[model samples]
Target: MDEEDSQIQKTQLAMTVPTTRVDVLVIGAGQAGLATGYRLAQEGVSFLIVDENQQIGDSWRKRYDSLTLFTPRSLNALPGKVLDGDPDGYPSRDEFADYLANYALHYNLPVQTNFRIASLDIEAEALFWAEGADGSAILARAVVVATGGFQVPVIPEIAGTFSPQVRQLTPETYKGPADVEHGPVVVVGDGASGRDIAFELSAFKSVILSRGRNRRLLPEKLFGISMWKWLKVLGLLRAGPNSPLGRAMRKSDPFPSRERSDRDLEKRGVVLASRLIGANGKRAVFADGSTLDVGAVIWCVGYHDDFTWLMIKAAKDQTGSIVVKDGRSPVPGLFFIGRPWQRNRASALVTGSTADAQRLVDDVEQYLSSTRQGEGSIALVAK
Candidate 1:
């Protein structure tokens, strides 16, 4: 938090004008967006990354301060640089943001902070165009949709109601216990975020609402090798959502267990209640036939995908990810990178995304070469 660093954060925070275009346009400047842009720069591709937020890593920065990534530092790096500070330690929320900003500056990635993409429309000639924040637009011969999966929060619809005095917020907006006004807090959702938040607020009085047992937390390592290493060996990491690993995870009725344990939550007296039935004023009813009075409720239920802003109609499954027919898209010149299992088990990981980016460069090179050939043919016809 030096003076210079502080100033840089401030400059990026200002949400000014928001419109422009470039040869290639990337939406969302999180880990995926920045990684894609950095790789594109190396291949001499004239591209720009635009984010709705005012700065890089805004998504990660907005999370609760106590948050540290589940994965270690070595697994959380981008192309060309490793995360600073502790190479093996899980970075703090802000440290991760700093790492992202540095990654952008290090490579001089052409990222336009605060340039929120309003809508992407296709003009004539099959050009992919995106309308920027102001009203201007960028048209590219190709587009990479790296919006990622963690933008929206999914709040469940429960019965009953709480009084106005009860405070409720999602983990997306939960800063810390200090952010709460006062009193005991009841957190819902047994996912990682739920467990973490419950642990954080336990000292101030807290309870965790477990909807149903899904995944139990396991350490990253079993013996000497990391669990990810074992997963890689078993080919579980490379398995697509249609693969056996993916099918088992998707079909598991309760939920897939977590990779890490919630011992902190359990030790802090965080009650593991069943699904919430309803709320009556200050009392919350649980499926276990129990009731408790809570001063606050925090939901950590995860997110959904919304690609309404993307105008191109490509072949997408129910999840909105472009279906890869042998690592190629139905739309020629349109490519996808940093997607889950786009390549190997590492495709979605930060380090793995770079590998995906390199693969994307191959597609980019072919597309540009084809574009030049098309233009030459048109010139010959005019002659």
Candidate 2:
């Protein structure tokens, strides 16, 4: 090889070295984790962000190639950087990843790629440990679990007698229409992913599925007002559970536009079914007392929150969500951002986490200062 080409390869090898320890540790290098890192960097605090992916943007890049954000580009951006594409259009999956990578580089955030956090343990002090691709263990102080809701895919257990001829796949494992074997496809679940997948696949084959009958779809805009604008104006999106709008939102699915209408799917030759009861080879039973034969089944059922690796017993509820009251958790030094109804309507959105991150930053400063002053010390410890 030429000398210049050999030197370039050597420089690439120099960048992959890993290190341990930081003042703060953020896990899951997706939107939330990266945002937290950016804010911490701005504050000049020593911190490190890590992810399980071998390369940056692996999370977004692994999704189906045709996937696009439901939210407009204007609403989806990392801290300090706006998406470079059309502001009016929903960005493709790759474009979103490009934005994130740019955000990390612009801030010069110290992110250790390919490092996967294995577990967190807290005794008198918090201990964070992770396993890297090279089989090295890295440790840190404060830990922010930004793993988000998409890690685990939940597939329901249905009684069955299958001939082993029918194939099944989850949205996580789905790559494209080319991945499925030839024949009719049955997609289970009526959530956003299910509908989008079914719609995309309907063009190629006759599809069938089940759904909630009374589900409502909210237009991104009503009249000339963006739905986001209305949510903010009507005070519906950010209202607390005690507030009328917040109460209504909590009871309603946020992305109602995702589910296809019965007539809409029927126009595409997709059959809407009630439920899956049991299976017999290619034939399946439904809750409405129906049977059908299909070549493939795609289960798009929602996920369950699993925090078994985290030792924060007091912070989580039975469902593994951090219980918040007035934007504060029960555990000290523990704050949750990007969770449903954590603060305002934007709590769960990519852009909305900035507010939550700022609040948590302020809280962290106050906590450290108070501890240094010996005011927050337990009375029993004095003995």
Q: Residue 92's C-alpha lDDT in candidate 2?
A: 86
How well is each residue in 1-383 modelled by candidate 2, as lDDT tens digits? 85467445434533454436555667778887888887877776667778888767888888877888777777787768888776757788888888788788888888778776554544234433333556444444455667665667776676246446777878778888987775678788877678888888999877887664345667657885566556656766556655777666666666536336556777777888887868888887788888888888888877666666665567778877656664455766555555656676567667566767777666655654554454332211100
Model 2 backbone overlap count: 0
RMSD of 2: 9.8
Q: Roughly what TM-score does model 2 have, to 2 decimal places?
A: 0.82
Report each candidate's C-alpha RMSD, comma-separated, in the order given.
9.2, 9.8
lDDT of each: 0.68, 0.68
lDDT of 1 by residue, 47-118 (tens): 777778788888788889898875567778887787866555678888888889888988888777887677
For model 1, the superposed segments whose C-alpha errors exceed 4 Å read: 1-21, 224-226, 229-235, 249-263, 313-330, 339-347, 374-383
**TM-score of every model?**
0.81, 0.82
